[model samples]
Target: MPTASVKLAVIIVSYCNVDDVDRCLKSLGRSDWDHFEVFICENGGEAAYGKLLTALVGADRTLQRASDGASALDRPHKRLASVTKCRFQNSAIVVRLGLATENLGYGGGVNAWLEPLLGVLGWDSVLVLNPDTEVERRSLSELIAKSAEGFGMVGGSLVFDSAPDKIINYGLHWSRTTGRVIAIGRNAPVGSAPSSDDLARIDAISGACVLATRSFVEDVGLMAEDYFLYMEDLDWGRRRGKYRIGFASKALIRHVGGTTIGSAVAPEKRSHLSIYLSARNSILFARRFAGWRWICHFGVGLLFAARYVLKGSLSAGRIALAGLLDGAKGKTGRPDVAPRPH
Candidate 1:
């Protein structure tokens, strides 16, 4: 088959994690298909950190044929090239060091700066990757291939940081039968190899590593800005039926989850915010576009809330319930800063 003529532009929104940024850049060097450019949007730092990052990751070096240096992220990069069959022939450059004056959370930060740039450049696809993740060599090729198969949004499997053998996410699943939200291939150890055909038909894909077409962005718009952090992906996913969201089993990214937003162990407010936004926006999303069957969506969310409470996340469960109520009441919460764990 002939290779598709789509050019890709990668957008990574960075927040206070320089090491991860370095690793992420290193992984980009391993991309199997390289007709792409990358834009790193850094938020929540003084200029110094971004400059230091650039120095370490070759920001000053002019874009040329891909070369090598002694950075730790580079060694594995070289190994990737030796093993992978796909060509990493990307022409890449760090256009500018983007540092926001203040934090814009996730959705706000990415949308404000990157969307306009993507629109102007006319890239066929825009990949929004978490700074904490590293892509495998075939990652881009797989995403491109799957998108070519008719999915507007393409997501890959995420391996756990501590146990690279373990799969953190395969894709997102919606259970119309149970109203439950499920993640495909969760906690399955790597090399286990779940069927790619299953992932191709998933209900959604997490935003941690998603490749979306320009049409997806223009139609759905940047994630609902009101969501700030959580559920923005789910919101985007729900809208995807209009364009058909899908998963790319061949593409892979490893994520060090909970680096930015702490997990359930985080403080009450932090945990609460995650639950709140997830619940509220999910309901808001279902209500707005779920058509006449929203009652089913509501029922499923309630059951999902019960599971959280049963799991001993009482506060988080309460927040989820409250968010549902708020969404039902059409209450729009202000974007607030919840403390991050140390």
Candidate 2:
């Protein structure tokens, strides 16, 4: 297939975080690849956040067109080598917003835009990214290049936004026995490089930033919507067998982990919502995929709950136990809980 025919669609799912969305869009504006479109999927955020995202998209579209014109010929970037001049002239990268009437959860928000993205827009590939992530200028190009090399699902390197020099994840590994998802290179210095073999295959890739081809989506299907917020990526990776998952080390993305779910909250006082969803999803994933091994997972979960209790987080421990019970009973969807008092 010709490079021009390989169109990229970028999808970002956001909820009540307009500032992070703004920063993410600005970073995207610096992308060297010009053959992509951005879709912002707003999942039941406040009206103010929706307005801000709309305004930012308008400004970004104008700026992108202007910059494309100014740099059309003069000092052409090396990354534009694959792009034909004719295609570049006719193609206009656009940013669009898709607002949801209600909270669609993480998987649902991205799925909501799949029809229009794959069918109406006719994009060949889709990059699902979180609103709290900022991509490096060459990130998209690197991911697209890897995709062309036949990787069905390609993920970028994620670095900590707070500690720019520290790596957060190069890929992920899910253990069926323990029902835990492990980060491949957590907290390692960015300068340290992994062996080529290590980068070649991983159990899974972080959903914070992943690029998937249309063929892969068609064959493997979209993220499991029942997971709602957590463990959907693990489920997707574990189930897909037709295509291999790859990591693009050259593509760098800075992620502010848990921005939407309060990563900043002290471990001892973490929000009930976060604790509940994580526990419930882990059990659900284990039971669905691990079969009888869920007994081992239950034991591991008990240890986790006990740790929280030892740390004086009584609420977190109790919520986690409740989640485990609910998940075993086949309960799903967003749970109703009152907002935490300020």
Candidate 3:
């Protein structure tokens, strides 16, 4: 059911990078495509920057404020009593300028806005771009064309910030041996073309620069919200047997990768949530999709964890272990502040 009028809804979820969001919108304004609407999902910021973003992008830009809102999860209201008792009384001093609600990781933030973009706005395709990214003029056109080939998901070439020709990630690849996923073309001396065949058929693509058709959304469905920050892309990519996922190599964007978490955030801490989710969700994903293959996958994860600890990223190992514990406890939400970056 292809529509004659294809409207793309581009969503950028903003946490702390107001400058990055401003640059992203400027890049989007230079896009060659015409039929699109952009929205910013704001989770934990003052309304001032959000208002400034809306002014730059357009007055029609939708801003979904997560602050000052009730928990999306249903815990007993009494449980929040303690968190509120201390913070609520003093909240009047800074609540309006600070985060009103809890942080919804990448999946939750994007889904919050995208669900409405699809259900209410009747958009035919949805594009999820990171705030820290700036797009090339040709990127949008290339993504739309690749997506038209019946793939439920599509990703573009991502370069490091401002190094347009230098590739950051051409796409993502999964390692069976380590149960690890690596960004292809990571810091690879810039401007080498990726495999055309690989681009045409992929296991998964990064959510960083991806587009999904309406049917893709209705069928494969929105990103799994349980993953607060990471692995949703892998989870989405694992669904490829039931859906199509491809790469638009011609499309290009730049990422200031690891903005929220520092490069030194320790592999264990940096990847704690990732390790836990990769472990638990890999099992969950395999149970639903991969079958016996996950046993082998868990073995690979152990080896990978060992490699991280051996490399002196004990924090990452700690985080990964914590993630596993949380997953085992069936926890679903963002971890607090990530140990303040050492």
Candidate 4:
């Protein structure tokens, strides 16, 4: 029997990664838990929405439901996104595609679905997932179990999809002293647990895979949209109020890291956007939460920019400096640069 009591809505805020969304939807289709529906917000706008429809059809050629067939009350996020293109009722998965007219960044994209899904459609919980991640069959079950254990927000273990034995992170460690956000268990072997020392400084869970109860969201409020992309998850974690955060190592997931954004094994080879947003968000975060220590965050941004210069990536250094200046000038929301392509 389905756990009708636990109404979970898995939210995936996708930019332009239709293929990744397809694979992720296929993965979600295998979930053992039977009380959840998926809402994918296509933040990449109309073109990506077209790609999403094609991918959805390819993912499941079984049932087809046109937007005109759905009632206004049945389809949530339609007020924000376009609407569901097709649906699959055979498995536990129910895919609803939300097409945005413009890029909503990460937080904005996720927020587009939350208000309507949690309110009008009526789901008690939401699991924010990256389109590039494929969760384990028991992932949802573990997250719900952890949340039932009293955690208002819960995160699962994330391993690299390319190197399944290597872990991406268990959570995140936000450094006040150095203004660095380090993955708690970066590159560690699979199935390893975070030590107490590591857990002590884990200020936030990785946004790659996080679940939150409706009560916590209603109390703490929705994720801040000011951070259009990076650092929004850390900001969300810091605002948990009286609620507690937890980790479910058993809820294993494989993440094709930085799919929408370019990445490299080496720090110097990372994309300009990644470097820029990281440096900018650090200062913005400090200013809002770090009191006078915002200066330290600014200094850290300078250090980051210098790293690129030392590594002979002057263009990256320039972008990093721009991010620092923008953050210092109280810049909020998405940068004016074009997003990476699908």
Q: How high is the CA lDDT of each candidate model? A: 0.65, 0.73, 0.61, 0.79
| Pairs with steric clashes in candidate 4 | 82-99
Query: Estimated TM-score per prediction?
Result: 0.72, 0.85, 0.73, 0.92
Q: Model 1 off-target regions past 4 Å? A: 1-5, 45-92, 175-180, 189-201, 264-272, 290-325, 331-334, 340-342
lDDT per residue for candidate 3 within 1-342, as digits (tens), equals 233377777877767766777678667767777567665555654554445444433234322222343432211121111111101121121111122244667787777665544546446788888888888898888788877887778877788775666777766776544445677766664445567664543557787878888877777777887767666777777765566776677788888866654442345455344445555554444434445565666566566657667878776566555554454455666664243543
| lDDT ranking, high to low | 4, 2, 1, 3
What digit string (tens of lDDT, one per residue) describes model 2 on residues 68-159?
33322222222111111111122366665556556778887777666544445457899989999999998898898888888888887789
Local accuracy of candidate 1 as per-residue lDDT tens digits, 1-342: 117568787877777777777678778886777777676556655653446344443434322324443333222221111100111223433323355555666776567545555436546888888888999998888888888887788877678877787787667765544444677788987745447676554666787888888888887777666666765676677777578766666677888865666653443334556667667766666666666565777777787678777876676667778877776766654434253332
**Steric collisions counted per model:** 3, 0, 11, 1
> What is the per-residue lDDT of model 4 for residues 13-116, given as tens digits with 9 covering 90 to 100?
88888788878877787788878878778887788787777766653453255445454424444446477745664553456778765777888888887876
Better of 1 and 3 by TM-score: 3
Instruction: Show the lowest summed lDDT stretch of 10 residues, model 2.
Output: 79-88
Greater lDDT among 2 and 3 belongs to 2
The lDDT, on a scale of 0 to 1, for candidate 4 is: 0.79
Model 2: residue 145 alpha-carbon error in angstroms: 0.5
Badly placed stretches (over 4 Å) of model 4 are: 1-4, 58-63, 66-81, 339-342
Cα distance off (Å), candidate 3, residue 244: 2.7
